[model samples]
Target: MASMPGPTDAFARPLTDLRVSVTDRCNFRCRYCMPREIFGPDHAFLERDELLSFEEITRLVGLFTTLGVHKVRLTGGEPLLRSDLPTLIAGIAGLDRITDLALTTNGTLLPRHAADLAAAGLDRVTVSLDALDDEIHRAISDTRVPVTAVLAGIEAARAAGLPVKVNTVVKRGVNDDEITAMAAWGRREGITVRFIEYMDVGATNGWRLDDVVPAAEVVERLSTLGPLEPIGDGTPGGDVGDVQTGPGQVAERLRWSDGAGEVGVIASVTRPFCRTCSRARLSSVGELFTCLFATSGTDLRGPLRDGATDDEVVTIARDTWTHRTDRYSEERTAETARDDRVEMSYIGG
Candidate 1:
């Protein structure tokens, strides 16, 4: 048998997490990620051969584990939409070096698949839930998809014994009004809810700086409903911070937790955590993205399909990661001007 690979020759940034997009297809068309009208019938998605198969994904993941990545999150435009996803999950979970294996989905298909997914050894699940009210949810998602389905999906995942995190992208004048309601639902369900800033991820979203509902404002809005005392960060591996920067930032940190389940804000836009950003995204088509806002990615698929050894793939992945210096959020002004960035649906959130 081949000896295990050594420390990555060029890996840097203290990398520890990898997000793999299993498919580029989504059932819902969230305005920010993929507006429905634009993504209608004519838009071309990846063909069957373009996507990395389960075996190919496992090989890439094995190399990532060798390069000091310990956690992996399966994502997609909507991961659950992919058929037999649990089989893929089981394969990745079998990798002993991968301590954490989670998935992010739109929750439209989770109710039917949650149990199987948990049984397949997925460690955790996060579902995107934009609103509690069906009308508002339909508006936010830009589809007739009901909010009830997503809520039921969350309940199913919880019943399946999988820890669930509800993710909401709060856009000012849009879903921001639903923050408190969503938090109340989470508290009742005993699920951790994370509010994400409306990010300028892809050019298709028509991201406007005015649309961003700052993390500070989200906590304040929730605090008005009840006294939410700060608790420890729900997951240590979570990108959100547990520490307060100063008195000014303290309110933003503690105001939304009632000591039951915590509220997290991924301040990717307002508070850039680029220096500690240790994420690498593997697109469904086998390109590796160093940054979520990146316009281009190195094609690992070509090399892998060409019979490149694990060492060669590892070297390619390592070189791409080490020379990494992407802080799009910090340099938001400059990044906003670039036109060819990959859409969030293609890269997974």
Candidate 2:
């Protein structure tokens, strides 16, 4: 098969990864992404009719694959909450062009669905596990669920033969004390725990520079636990000691020099990788957002529902990407920070 034309943006970045949000509801109200104070019981989530159907999502995935999107991750406020997720997973996995199929979840529900998710062609899973300390975990996630539940989910995912990666959002005073604990746990379990710098993704969460824990600080803290080395550093034809594990890879992966284990860090705020970001996000309602901090998205749902053909939808998406010039994180400022960016809950982080 000849190569399909890539949707190269204004900065010459091709769309290689797509994060599709299947639903805008979650079980846990993580303070960083979604806070209970705001997303309370009365909060209005997208109605079932407003969300894209599984078939519509599958069609969009097919279109994305043709635009050089080889990696597709199913995300959500909590993807498992979307009913019959395996069916959607099977549809995307069947698209031969989608070489990588993954999902990001809070992990509380993985124990029941991991096997089913894996059976339906999921290649791997990323679980948002902020801390192993039960109290700290509850504090960050703002949920009554115990930490052991998430651990069980991780075990279930591994039992299902799916590679698991844990994501920890490091905020200075919130979970910073547990950095070493989390790293040690990851080393002990042979799971790659990625520490993400506290980012100002949405309008809420009381984001502040003081709360932000720089990636360099995280590396320093982990170094106290063990001698860490970049995954490919000091080796021939290997990536140097940087957050970049590979081309367009966001995390800078490193390993324990003593042969214990490995971890990664995403320094979006301090060490921005906007220049090489190849991700395009689709909201539950079919809006395409070029940047995670985007205030608005091109409404593909309206166009598609209004009787637009597949060719027309493709043209619209391609045109949006080709004309994209967003680099929000790299240019983040107090003024821009208050730009009413879309909430991370609405669009999967």
Candidate 3:
């Protein structure tokens, strides 16, 4: 098949990844992404009628593929909360031009659905697990769910033939002590573990600059466990498949000197990669956000539900992306970071 025409934004960044939020409800209220005080019992979530149907999501995925999105990741407040999610996964996997299809989850429910999801054509799974200690894990997730259950979920994903990458968000006073433990565990388990700097992504996370444990510090801390070598230095003239530590990638790849394992650090707060960011996010309600820190999104739900044609939806998406010049992370400041941004739960982290 002929390749789809590539669309570039004002900064000339091509769109290649799309994160689709299937739902806006989660079982756990992580302190970073979703705090309990704000998202309390009375907090209202999107009704079923407000969400984009599986068919609608599939249509948008197809449209996005036509504009150079070969990778699609299913995300949510917790995607497992969505009913019959495997059906949506199958629908998206059936589409042409999607080279990669993955999902990001908290892993509370992966044990029950891992095999089904793999059968439905999921390529890989990125599980969010912060601490291995039960007490710390419970505190970070703000739930009674045990750490053992999440580990079981990871094992289940592996058993189902799905490659797994574990994501741990490191906050200074919160879970920074677990850096070596998490890295050691990843090395032993043979799963690539990534440490993400605590970011001021949404308006309600009560973000503070002091809370962020810089990626450099994390790598330095890991070196105490074993010698670490940086992978993918952003140098010119390397193999095409070689991971380049440059713009667009959220993570800086690294490996153990002993060759036991590899790790990644996502320093979006400190080492911003806005120049080559190729991701566009779609909310469960069908709003298209050009940037993670965007205050507003183009409401595709209105146009689609109002009987707009496929070509019309494609034009809206293409035009919105074509005119994109978002570099919020690169320009983030103490004052600017406090600006009202969409809640990460509404979209996806």
Candidate 4:
């Protein structure tokens, strides 16, 4: 038996979570994410061979596991759009070191893949659903994708025994009106609805400081339906803040000082939590991103393809994480207001 390697951060900002983008392709043309105009029919995505193979990804995951990554999330432009993604899920699940394994998807393809993903050892799922109405959803996403597809997908995930979480990005003058309705939908479906403040992760979204519907407004709107009690704060892994919503008012995962179903806000725009951001993202092309708003990443593809040793990769990974001082959202209104940032599609959300 071999002993595990010691950690690098003394559990300070430890590498506990890894988000791997399986593909840079998606089905919808979300205006904020991957607008069709920028990623039109002529867009050149990475070829199948250019992507990190499941075998290669698993090797890296094994290394990440040894370096203290206990949770893994599969993300992408849309993860299910990738071929045989459940196979990749199973491969990661086989690694016993991972305590929590999850996937984030657009939910357009989830109805077809939920059970298979759960069977592949996926522990949970987070679905990106901006609206409940078909027309509004299509308009917001800049695609004709029906909201019923997402609803059906959520149902399928529930039936598959996967704990479902719904993420709604609240963009002012867009889908912000749906906050209450979205929270209602989540409560009815037994899903945790997390409202995320509109962020300027990339330069393509036409992000303006005024376009951001603050997290406080999200709570206020949802409070219209029912009284929202402040559930105590959760861990720093996701920067989730407390708010509970329900009819009977019974909260589950969130330890509510007053009982109700849990609701949270990812205050990326107003209350940036970059200091506690412990997650790292790996692009489908094998680039490693230290922060979500990063303009560029260290190209691990070259080194990995060239047969870099695990020790070398891990050292690079640690150095990158330790040296990271990104606070993009916090500085956006000031320093980055005039700067151009990378598109979210290239890095996955």
Note the clash tally of each candidate: 0, 1, 0, 3
Can you write out model 4's per-residue Cα lDDT over 94-172, one digit (the tens) per residue?
9978877888888878778888999999998888999997888999888877888888888889899998888888888
Report the error of model 1 at residue 60, Å.
0.5
Stretches of candidate 2 off by over 4 Å are 1-3, 233-245
After best superposition, candidate 4 residue 8: deviation in angstroms? 5.7
- Each model's Cα RMSD: 4.1, 2.7, 2.2, 4.5
lDDT order, best first, reads: 3, 2, 1, 4
Spell out the clash pairs found in candidate 4. Answer: 249-260, 250-260, 251-260
Tens-digit per-residue lDDT, 1-349, candidate 2: 2346988999999998899999999999999898999999999889999999999999999988888888899999999999999999999999979878989999999999999999999999999999999999999999999999999999999999999999999998888999999999999999999999999998987787788899999999999997988766422113733222345668887889999878888888888888988899999999999999999999999988898888788889999999999898899876766668899988899
Q: Show model 3 residue runs off by greater than 4 Å.
A: 1-4, 234-247
Report model 1's TM-score to 2 decimal places.
Answer: 0.90
Error of 4 at 111 (Å): 2.0
Error (Å) of candidate 1 at residue 94 is: 0.8
How far does residue 33 in candidate 3 sit from its true spot (Å)? 1.0
Q: What lDDT, from 0 to 1, does candidate 1 have? A: 0.79
RMSD of 1: 4.1
